[model samples]
Each structure stands twice: as structure tokens, then as C-alpha cells.
Target: MPSRRAVLAGISTGALTSLTGCVSTKRTGATPGTDSNTDWPMFGADRMRSGYAPSAAAPRSSPTERFTASLEGTPIGQPIIADGTVLQSTWYGIEAFDAVSGELLWRFRDEEPGDTAVQYQPPAVHDGVAYVGTESGLVALDVESGDEQWRIETASRVSAPPVAGYDWHHLYIGTIEGELLEVSLEDRASSSPGTVRWKRSVYGEIVRLVAPNIAGVTAGTTGGEVYMVYDGRGLWRTKVPGGVTAMTAEQGNSLYVATFGGGVLKLRTAAHAGRVSWHTEVGPVAQGLLVRAAGAVYGADGGGLTKLGTDGGRERWTFAEAASTIPAAAGDTLYIGGTDSILAYKLSGGTGVAGARIDPQRWQYTHDGGYASGVSIADGAVFAAVGDEPRLLAVE
Candidate 1:
């Protein structure tokens, strides 16, 4: 395989543009039908942020690269797959591409020539609209044509990804200034976007926001506090030992939170009260998303990737790779993106004992850009953004 830089250097500007144009015609400008069971939508599969694809069957062996497409700007979040299209949020704008052929479909830019609107998080797509957050505000665009449907300005920078309610009738977003805004979907139907259904202020900068299994929103703050809100009122607040780094993942009635202070906490998200069931110190939690699978909760940080038993929060297994991105799982196979390569691991044995370990024989994909933004899997294919220049890599 050629180095990423070599492959990129070999392609001329005209040739790349021509290839992009060829793939553009393959798109029909219609919203592609979606298979909810196989699609990896939202930040971590769903509002719970589980980062687990239950219906996906990831390749058992290391897969070969299918294609790579360059983007306009840096991608700081995971790419979302739906309706045969892959949606990516970059610093400059939001882009859509044909999922199988690596063709550019459409691009949406909300900033002016000299204006700056940094979009570092993934966009949540539901029905036919893609909701994305920018430094200035949130914007909704048509998934098929990349046309702006509505734009709503925020009081401050919108840094995290927006999540849709379970009913798909509401959108939840948090800002850097600690304001959580709930936007009405019915208002968007009436051509009124940004209608504030309700807004609540939390204690510190809100970095990770998720909608739990219960009726309200859960937000983790930079001040190490997790706040649960219903309507416009605070329901419960729990302080972790350290600053919260990522969104919480839910299983049954439990919420799993990763903290920078080197621990993962299991809490109950019922009755407007969050009660910690167990707190297991696992290295420093990564500043990305946390994943739950089988009977374990997986987290990564500067220390490495650690798996803790979901029952009593016991350490199951730890891999010594410095990871800052969330891990994705399909079946018993877990895929993690590290600083330079994508690794494949097998979750062996039953519920207890050491479950996950790196498959030393499995083929690993190496790139010059490094796998910084994480990985996502759908329909037997693995998707990732590699290197600092960031090209979307598809493997199967």
C-alpha cells in the first residue's frame, strides 16, 4: 500500500475534481432510504451514545482499503452513516458523500468568505435533515441537496454535537457557555427554525451532552459535574472525582460516564436522580466518547484503552495504546483508532475474566495522517478519518 502522502501527491487537482464530478452524478438528489438497524447515526449510534452497532457485522479479519476522499477542512468528530450517504462535519462546513463509491455529493457552508464558523462535532441526521452545530449557531440542511433549511444563532459557540430526542420531535444541544437549548421540530415544520422550546443553564462549560433512557437530557460539564434536566428545571446533579471528558452511555437504566480524573462511573438515570452504583479508576479517561458492549464499558485516555466489567466495575482488560478517540464495536469485535493505526480486538470468553485482547494476527491499517478522529462501522464496512489533512477511509 502506498503512503497517504504518496497517494495524495500522485493525484492531480484536475483528476481529483473530475473523479468527484463522476461520483456526484451517481447521486439522484433524493434522500436515500435508511436501514435503522445497520446505520451508525448521531454521535454514538443513538442519544444514549452507546457507540455500539448491534446489527453490524464487522469484518472478522483485517479488511483492505476501498477508497479515500479528501475533505475541505479538518474533521474533529466521527462521520455518521445514513440513507446511503456519509455525513461529515468539518471546520469550514458540512459535506455529504456517496457511501460506497467515495464520491462527493454536496457541501453546505454557513460562513461567509471572511467569516469563521468552526464545526468540530458530528451532525445528527433524522428524516431528511442534517442538524449541525457551528461556532456561531446550529443549522439544518437538506441531506439530499445540501440546501439550508434553517439557521439558528446561539448565545455562544456551539461546540458539541446535537442529539435528537427519541421521538424525533425535539433537538438537544449544549454550548460552551453552559446553556442547553431544546429546539422544537414542529417549529421547523412551520418554517420557523430555532424556536426555543426551553433552555437551561448549568454550572460550567458543557462539553458532552446526551439524552438518556429516561425523559430528560444529561450533560457533563468541565467542572466535573453531571446535570440532568427535565423541561427547564434541574432534576439532579452529581459531581465526578474529576472533569467529565465525554458523553454518557446508557444500558438498561444505567449511565456510564468517563472522567479525566482517571475513572469511569456507573450511575442510575431514573427518577430525576443520578446515583453512582460504582466508580472504577481506570487511567485518565480520553477526551472522546465512551462505549458499552456485551457486559463491559470501554474507555480510552492518555493511559490507554481499558475495559471494566459492567456489573461491579471491575477491571477486565487493558490495551497499552494511547487512544484519545472513542472505540466502536460490532458483535464481539471491537475497533479502536490510535495515533497511527486502526486496531482490531476480540472480546473473548463469557461475561467475567479478561474479555478483550488485541488480535495480533489481524491485519491493521496504517496511515501517515494517524487515526485521530476515531472509527465507525456499518454494513460490514469500517469508516474512519485519518491523518491531520483528514481523508475518509473505507475498508471492507
Candidate 2:
């Protein structure tokens, strides 16, 4: 890909004012979602922040032939697994459900009935602290204790979960106004909010205003700028191009970035964006959702699971098992959620999909939704959320 853009042109102070000014109105639209079980709290399940859920969930049937409910909405966000329960968020507040039984556990509707709304992304939980994001900002609730912690307006909209780790746990996110922020989650977690850790622009010069998707923050900036500041150690502000959305596929020091229009770009995360490792065309995938395992890279691009050969982004296999859901993995199996069905697959080879096992009917038959932004494996079953409805789903 081309090198990062030259120094960012002058950004008028007015733009910042308008962006900050608009933040107040962001809250007027958030849905009030809450959780019942605190075990598998937060977006990634634990504070170490890995998007994997753990629970001894039994699939309805071996090689399940069909899905079960009419839950409604798509799987645009990842689901959290906890105490045999699943938690998810959508345009509504947080919704909790029984993972194995597929039962609604609790719903937190913080929004007023007449309020206009935008989709609020999933939140993260640690030590019982639940963190949910909205168009207005980030809100904190105690999962086990059942209490509100602190609510901070961080953006016109937050499309990703607040990532936590290190002594100074931080909330990483993007805004509709086109900016990136890293706030200290340590504050809310500890009941003491701190100053904004660091803020960066993603437009003009090295930054390209990027509004992340529900998958979370996976960005690669320009001018050799490459950042993935989950914790303080991985914190970097280098330069690369190909604006980053929530979707990211990384292995070792390499970060595979996808864009909304341009396509997937490979960035070397040497903490120095001065070099371009390689470039390949994966189309302008709306989400560059991917994970690496056993020397292979799997992602949800276009509308399926793509198994690629790492060296140059060559396709080894493609499975349209579920459309658009960020593919998740457990052991040797991969889970996919689609508009109407949720599917699972075990790699058969390096040339095309080997085989697929799908739930013939919609797992939650209520609505034809499955943005499957993220997935997790715990105990044995898989946990994910459906889109729109923000219903938590657990399909064994």
C-alpha cells in the first residue's frame, strides 16, 4: 500500500469544539442494558481481555441440524460467557440470558422510552464492574453487585469495548466525530476516574478519521503509524496507512488491517511504521474480523470465513457458513453466526473449506440477525450475541 500521509494538515480548533460539543447529545440515545450473572463479565470475558467465554454448555444436538429461538436482531457484537449465562447489547440496553437454556435472564433499559437511539456496543466487565458503551459515552455497572459505577461521555458513539489491562487499565475506542481515545478504565474500576490517558486523531496527516465497528479497535494509521494500545506495553503510536476499523487479524508483530472501502492491508507492528511488509487485496471488507491459530489466519470478510495463507494473504479456503459475523475459534473448531443461521466448522484442509456443520434453523428463531462481531468458547459450548436485539446466544 502507499506510505502514510504526510504530516496532518492543520485541524481547526473549531472541529474539536464541534466534536466535543456534540458529545452531550450522544447520551440522549443510548439503550439501558444490564447483566445478571457476573462470572463472564465484560466484552472479552476477563480483564486479561481475551474474547473467549467459558462454560460447560451442551449443544442442543450433536452436529446440530437447526437453530432454536426467534430472539431477533443480528450478531453484530461478541457475547460474554459467565456462570452458564450469556450477556449482549444492541440498540437496546444490555440483555442477559441463560447460555445453555437460552432463557432471558435480565434486561437493563437505561434509555427513556421516547428517546431516539443508536446502537450501543457491548461492554467489558472486570471484578464485577460492567462497562457498556453508547453514542454518548461509557457507563459502568457492577455485574455481581448490581450497581452503577461511573458514566462518562467519551464519544458521539462508541463502537468498541473498553479494553483493560496493566496497572492503568484503559478504555480504547473511536467516535463518530472521527477520533481515537484511550481513557483509564482503572478509574471507574477503582471508583476514581482519572484524566484522559492519551488522545489521537485519525485523519488528515497521519490519522484517518475512522469510526470503528462493533468488533472493537484494530487500527493501523499512516506515515508509519500503527497502534494497538490495549495495555501500556502494546501501546504504540507509529505510522502506517489503511484506516483501521474494529476488525483486525494479528500474529506475532504483524497487524493485518481491513478498511471500510480500500481493503485489507498488512502492517508490520515493529512499533515503527517506517516499513510496509506486504499488501494484498481482500476487498473493502466492512469488518476485518480475524484470528490466528496453528500458522493459519481465519477471518470474516465480505460474507464468510476466509482461511488465508499468511505469507502473502493468499486464500487457502473460504466458507460462507455464516455471513459477516466475526469468526471465533475454540480448539480446532470455528464458530460462525449468520443472518438466519449459526454454523461451526473444523478445518479440513489448506485449499478450500473442508466441511461445515450448521444449525439448519436460526438458533434464536425470533429475528434473522447475526452480525456475529465476536465469539468465545468456554467449558465446551460457544457464546455469541445476535445483532439488533442484542440477545445473548449460547449454541452447543
Candidate 3:
């Protein structure tokens, strides 16, 4: 395939603004339909931040490049596949593309001409609106046309991706100032788009958040403090051993938290209190979103992916040389994005001996670019954003 580097020129600020400023840039005008079971709509595939996509028929053998598109900024968050479109969040804004053809559909950048604030969080698509975090606020854009529907400024910078329940009625997020925001999505269809339902003080730098259901939201702070807020009230609060780096929910009541202190803790989200289920040491410093799939929890830290059993948090096997991005698992295969390649590995089903090292390489798709992070799979297709040069690659 020929390089698409020549198409790197960004749309002029004025032109881009017009596209997002209530003007249609190829609006389908069709009401966004419900996403399929295989759609990787948001970060970690769902509001729980679980990076598993069990229904997606991911590639089993060596994957082939379908298409590639150059981007305008360094990609930060993971690629989101929803409603036949792939959305990637970069340092500047979000870029949407045709999931199959890799065509640039529409780009949304809310930054002013000289603003230096960066948008590091990924976007979440619910119903038909895409919720993206800007430097100081959250903006909702029409998924069909890139039209700006509404925006609400936060108390501080959004620290993680905005998440929503299945109904999309309430949006939840954390902030650098230790605030957990619950934004109402009920008014999104009205003339005025959004409303800040409430902002509760978490008392520490809130870094990660997960909304397992509409009534409850779990937030993790930089100080290792975790809180379970239900129905706009703090239901429970607890602390792990280290700074919380990421979190994932299993079966709605169980949460797996990866910490920077070299451990992954399983916590029970009960109505009365947050109880530690199990704490398993992974690497020297465990980080990244915990992935729950095939009856195991996967944590990444220090260039390795560790698989642990869900029953007792026992270490199963470690896949060394894992990349920076979270791995996507479906069925028996794990797809990882490396610096310049996307690799597939055959999962051992956690039946192997504990702490065993394994690397059953299945396939690899290479690109002559920078970091190939944000590996997302949906409907048998894999998508990744190559950072530095900023390019999106589609494979199947």
C-alpha cells in the first residue's frame, strides 16, 4: 500500500470550525441506531473499561492491512468502533473514519487557534452523540455529521474518558481536581444539549472511573483511594495498595483495579462497602486497564501482559514484550499493538502452570510508522492508531 503521508494537511481552522459549528459535513440525517454486540464503541469496549470483546470475530491468523489514513495529531486514546465508524482521540481532538475503507469521515477539534490544552482522554459514543473531553470541558458532537450539539465545562481537566451506562442517560467522568462529574444526557436531544447533574469531591486527584450501571459509578484516585457512588451519593470508599492506574468491571459487581505499586486488586462493589476480593502481584509496577476475558484478568506493566485467574487471582502466564496499549481479547486470541506492528497471540486458557512464560505468536501486521497503539477489534476487523506520524490502520 502507498503511504498516505501527502494527505496530512489539516483542514483549515475556519473550515473545520464551520463543520463542527452546527453545519453539516455529510450528515446522514438518520437517527443513530443501537450498536451491535460486537461494536467497540468506547474505551475498553464499555463503560466498565473492560478491554474484552468476546463477540467480535477478531482475526485468527495473520491479518492483512485493509486501509490506512494519516492523522493530524498524536493519537492518545484507543480507537473506538461504533456504528460502522472508527473514532480516535488525539492530542488535539477526535478523528472519525470509515471503519472498512479507512476514509476520513469528519474531524472535530474544539481547540481555539492558539490554545495549548491537550485532550488525552478517549471519546465515548452513546445513542448517536459522541462525548469527547476537551482541555477544560466536555463536548458532544453528532456522530453522523460532526456537528456540535452541546458542551459543558468541567470543574477541572477531565482526567479520563467519559463513560455512560447502556441507556446513556447519565455520563460520568473524573477530573484532575479530584471531582467526579455526573453529566445528564437526557437533554441531549433538546435544543440545549447537556447539563451538569452534579460534581462530588473525591478529595484526591481522580484518575480513573467506571460506570458499571446507571445507578453506580466507581472512581479511583491518584492516592489509591477508590469510591463507589450510587444514585448521586457516596456508597462506599476504600483504598488499594498503590496509585490506581486503571480499572475494569466484571459482572457489574466485581472490579479489577491495576495499581502502580505492582499489584492488581479485585474488589467487591457491595452496597455497604468496598471489599478486597483478591490482590495479585503482576509486575514490578502494574498499570494499564485490566482486561477480563476467557475467565481471566489481564494486566500490563513493564512491557509484559500477565494473565490471572478470576476465581483466586492466581497468575496464569505472562506474555513478555507486550506493548503499551491494552490488549484486545476475544475467544482464544489476544491482539496487541506494538511500536510498529500489531501482533496476535494464542491464549492458553489459564490452564497452564502459574507464572509460566509463554509466547505463542499467531500473526503480526507491520507498519512503517511510530507507535501502533490503541488496538481495537470489532466484527472481525482490527483498528489501531500509529502515533508520532499519526495514522490509523485497519486490518482484517
Q: Which residue pairs of candidate 1 clash?
A: 369-387
Question: Each model's RMSD to truth, in Å?
Answer: 12.4, 15.9, 14.4
| lDDT agreement of model 2 with the native | 0.49
Q: What are the per-residue Cα lDDT tens digits for candidate 3 across 1-396?
A: 422122222335564455454432222122212223478878888888878766567777777888999987888757988887888988767889888898899988887757784765788897778888877788888888889988888768888788885577778878888888888888555323477777788868777888886577889888888998876689889988888888888675888888886488888887537798888865324355777776677766665667777778887666655676766766567777765788777665222224322235677777877666668878577788888678998887
lDDT of 2 by residue, 37-131 (tens): 32445443443232222222324224431223334344446666555545666555676665666666566556676776556666665555666
Worst ten-residue run, lDDT, model 1?
Answer: 24-33
Off by over 4 Å in 2: 1-75, 187-195, 204-243, 246-251, 283-288, 348-374, 387-391
lDDT of 1 at 357: 24
Provide the overall lDDT of each model, using Cα atoms, as 2-decimal numbers: 0.73, 0.49, 0.74
Cα error, residue 207 of model 1, in Å, equals 1.2
Write one digit per residue (lDDT tens) for candidate 1, span 1-396: 774334445656575555543322211121222323477878888888888776576776758877789988777678888877888777767878888898999977767757765665788888878888877788888888888888788898886688877677788999999999888766555535557778899988788888864467889988899998888788899988888887656656788888887488888876637898888875338567877777777777666677677788887656665367767777666777876777766543222224222222244667667755778887567788765787887787
TM-score preference between candidates 2 and 3, better one: 3
Name the lDDT of candidate 3: 0.74
